[model samples]
Target: MKSSMHNPHLAPEKYGIMDGISECIVTTISSKGPNAAPMGIIKNSNGIKIRVFKGSKTYGNIMNFPFLAANVVYDPKIYTMTTFSNLERSQFDTIVYEDVEFPVLKDGISWMLFECNNLQKSSQSLVADLIPVKAKLSHIDAVRAPNRGFNSVLEACIHATRYQLTGSQKYLDLMQYHAEIIRKCGGKTEKEALDQLYRFMKTNK
Candidate 1:
């Protein structure tokens, strides 16, 4: 285990990834094309770790090519969009490393390129140790207070993803619970994001 402070090639703290779980969007490329999904990563002295369920585009893409880019994003709309719908080509920017083109979010504030190592698989999930090989900061951090409405929207997006995958009513129930908070505290973006999520859920169901 190596501390990120001593690592020359990668530093987790620079990307606002601390000791606990940091939520971000992970993008991976396959023969078909790029895939994006909201993911939570844990950063420790051991490095970054991620888990993805089987039968997902992210899971299959990483299995074929073990390289991915994790993008730090603050926008709730992006979370909702990626969790339910496929991102258009225009939403991505490309960076080539050793002839492999990795898709990055144009709206990402910062991103880290990782090579998935120490692959571990189970019946339900694939867990990988992410080794940060490259990183970039796309925008300067703006000064803004914390918004619970925005955070609630992200939480709802997670529940929505779970509901989509498992077709469970409990997840849908949880999403509706968060919808209350979004209506009460969220701004225009959060409200719009929630609406889009509900629309997707309606059509998918």
Candidate 2:
């Protein structure tokens, strides 16, 4: 079953009201095509906020096209793929809202489409204020996954990307620490994700 809202000014509780940094895979369409990247979104009384760093494709896309989709997903591969490399078109299911195009992961549980209403720029990144104009719920699991090692894996991916961009050994050290946690506490899927990240870092270095 599919569920959607035309203009959900504020995020609905059913979408799991995000308090602080909620990790999501954001998709935006540019002149080139669909682009996906992992972002941390914060739900506030005004709307949602995301930090788009300078010199990244996602930052440029958001500047050119204000409309983007934030997908709530749990798959670790999706997180790693979008962060380290580009995902193929076949990896996403296209959806249109208000005549704007956006891609949603086939396995995404929910999505929120927003238009940038405000932008605060700093030296390194731009903080965008977004208004939720469209939302959809395709699948809702009865039980939420335990965060035994999932959060660590996600954090590790972020650090991995930082390591790639800045060539900082500190980020690599942190990534390695998180990988150890995933090895000891994570399930099969988490282990797979950790392995994928490790391989990417090794080859790229």
Candidate 3:
């Protein structure tokens, strides 16, 4: 069976419903060491728009330094570890890729530059401002595999934020994932925020 996205590189014979949306683990560095977060990139009339949350580290970094790499690689661990506090990996080391900056533990790929001109927020699908920038994809690792267990939970944080931000219709699309994490991992303000997100998503919806 030939995939609609015909690339000999992709493992499975049939690539299902991921027709256009490309998911990338966005790596950014601020005064705070590293932020390896998962983000969705969509093609627009002008170029690519990186959809991220306003309160996320990625958002903060971009605000400080507008330059960032939309790292397109093959690691679900990046997403899982980005949001989860339980991954036992080596500490991040500062590595430079661009003349500007580089992230730790990168998989090397070439010719994968997708210009990000649009910066969409997790709050509104179409309201975020689109910033123009030129970036180079220096490396590419293996093709990305499916996320599961804790990885799946971390992936849901993106969803959780959307539910957290909206003035209306928040819960129906976002509350379910955050609730799961809170029930499983109880703690301080995180638990409060998750519960608050749930309440907000509910009443606002």
Q: Quick one: best lDDT, which candidate?
A: 1
Steric clash pairs (candidate 2): none
**lDDT for each candidate structure:** 0.85, 0.79, 0.45
If both were scored by TM-score, which would come out higher, candidate 1 or candidate 2?
Answer: 1
lDDT of 1 by residue, 102-183 (tens): 8999888888888888789999999998878778887766445888899899889889878988999999889988999999
Taking all chains together, the TM-score of candidate 3 against the true structure is 0.47
TM-score of each: 0.91, 0.89, 0.47
Badly placed stretches (over 4 Å) of model 3 are: 1-19, 85-98, 108-205
**Model 1 TM-score relative to the real fold:** 0.91
lDDT of 2 by residue, 1-205 (tens): 1223436454555665387778888888788988889988887676668888998888998888777678888778788878887789887888776555577777788887777767788999999876677778877754675775788889899899889889988998998889888888888888998888888888888
RMSD (Å) of each candidate, 1 decimal: 3.4, 3.7, 10.3
Ranking by TM-score: 1, 2, 3
